[model samples]
Target: MLRGFYGAGAGMITQQRHSEMLNNNLANAQTPGYKGDNASIRSFPEMLMQAENVGAAPGGRNELIGSMNTGTYMQERTPNFAQGDTRQTENNTDMAIVQGDVPVNEEGNSGALFFNVANEDGDLRYTRNGSFAVDGEGFLTTAQGNYVLDDAGDEIFVNNEEFTVDAGGNVFDDDGEELATIDISFAAAPEDLVKEGDGLLAVPEDEDALPTAIGDDDINYDINQGFVEESNVDLMRTMSDMMESMRIFEANQTVLQAYDQSMERAVNDVGRLQ
Candidate 1:
């Protein structure tokens, strides 16, 4: 009976965590370049039960019973990296990257690249949010004012000369003079990247997080200058998941209540007879 109570409690805790993850995904459904996360649950190991003594055919002997499942727990929250839909902003500063040869929309091309930006502490990070603007210093920077890095890993500085960025990521002035090339870097292993807050991905400080080179045939390297990527979360799916989690949570609560009542009866009502 005690084991049953523990199992129910574990279930309630796991369900609470799952609900939290679903809520987070729902809240970020409209966030640009936002990725959804899912909670993974793992069951506790089952314990083998054995009878102290049992009767075999015409003989008394010890026998093995079955196994009993203990409970489940939240293992980890895994982020989904599937590509999101793109929206055309018609803003010259907005940009988006194409994951592969199959474009996300008509404007997309083949490429697996991300824009590199620096934080206030000068620590480099990567992002797919291409909503950029020119700062007072005539430097291309993110909305948070982080300087965008170029191919040389330097801050890209541009004057208010009506600049344009091409699919090849080259910047040009109003006079058609090539000013600077925008940096589009590829991650050799994107799975190793970890999500920091504010739509940024951070590589471990100890690992070499430099962009890996790819041949022209391998990637289209196309950059759309007037678009932004939307969050990959599916609202309908998230709603359904949320409902399911709530139901499971209520079930666990019911089990816990039943166990509590059983214990109460055993202690108060049954103990009175003694």
Candidate 2:
């Protein structure tokens, strides 16, 4: 009877954390390049549960399992690394990288872009969103204000000169000569792909940062200019998850309340008489 109360307490704390995760995912459902987060409760250890809280007899010793712990045993953020859908915005700066042959490797990167995107010591910083433009300094920037890179694998710096990025991710000056090219790719390993703030992703590590899955002989990524990657989250699917989470939370609450009531009556009516 006493064990029921403690068990319920554990559940209440776990449910609270689950609800928080659901709310956050729903809020960011429309965010571009955004990944969803998940939460889960740690299952009760069966061995511990089999032990008696007060020894085998009445009022012996309180075991760890019997102690009421109104604490959360839930994981706060389990990041969802699933890919988002790509939507074509048709903007010149908006670019989409699909699986294809790698043309120009790299030249450098530009400082003005979004998602804090920047080159990592000559290595290319990766992203799913291609929406970008050349800033006053002739540096390419994303819609949210971060630098875009050039082929030398450095931040592109044009110093206010007008330029165009061709279908091959090449940057051209007003005279039509190639100044530099964008160094983007989709060949990063699953472990190598990492998240930057606000839908931007950074290379998982600086060492061995080049695309290994692409094979070392030559570059193998094709660029689709004028298209942007779409968000991977589905509204209908998220809503279903939300409902399931809520239902489980309510069930936990019910069990906890029943336990509390039972414990109260046991202590007041029987314990008081003893």
1-274, model 2: which lDDT tens digit per residue? Answer: 6666666667766766776777777787766665676565676654433244566677677556443334347854555545456677766666665543333313321111112256434334556567677677667776655687654556766567766666556777788888776765443233335655555666555455443322334444445666675655677877887788778778878987887887788779987788
Best by TM-score: 1
Instruction: Please write out the lDDT profile of model 1 over residues 18-114, one tens digit for every residue.
Output: 9999999988888877878977899999999987647655556777889999999999886776678889999888887757653232334232467
As a whole number from 0 to 100, the lDDT of residue 99 in candidate 2 is 42
Cα RMSD, each candidate: 4.5, 7.6
Compute the lDDT of residue 83 as modeled in candidate 2. 44
Model 2, C-alpha of 156: deviation from truth (Å): 2.0
lDDT of 1: 0.80
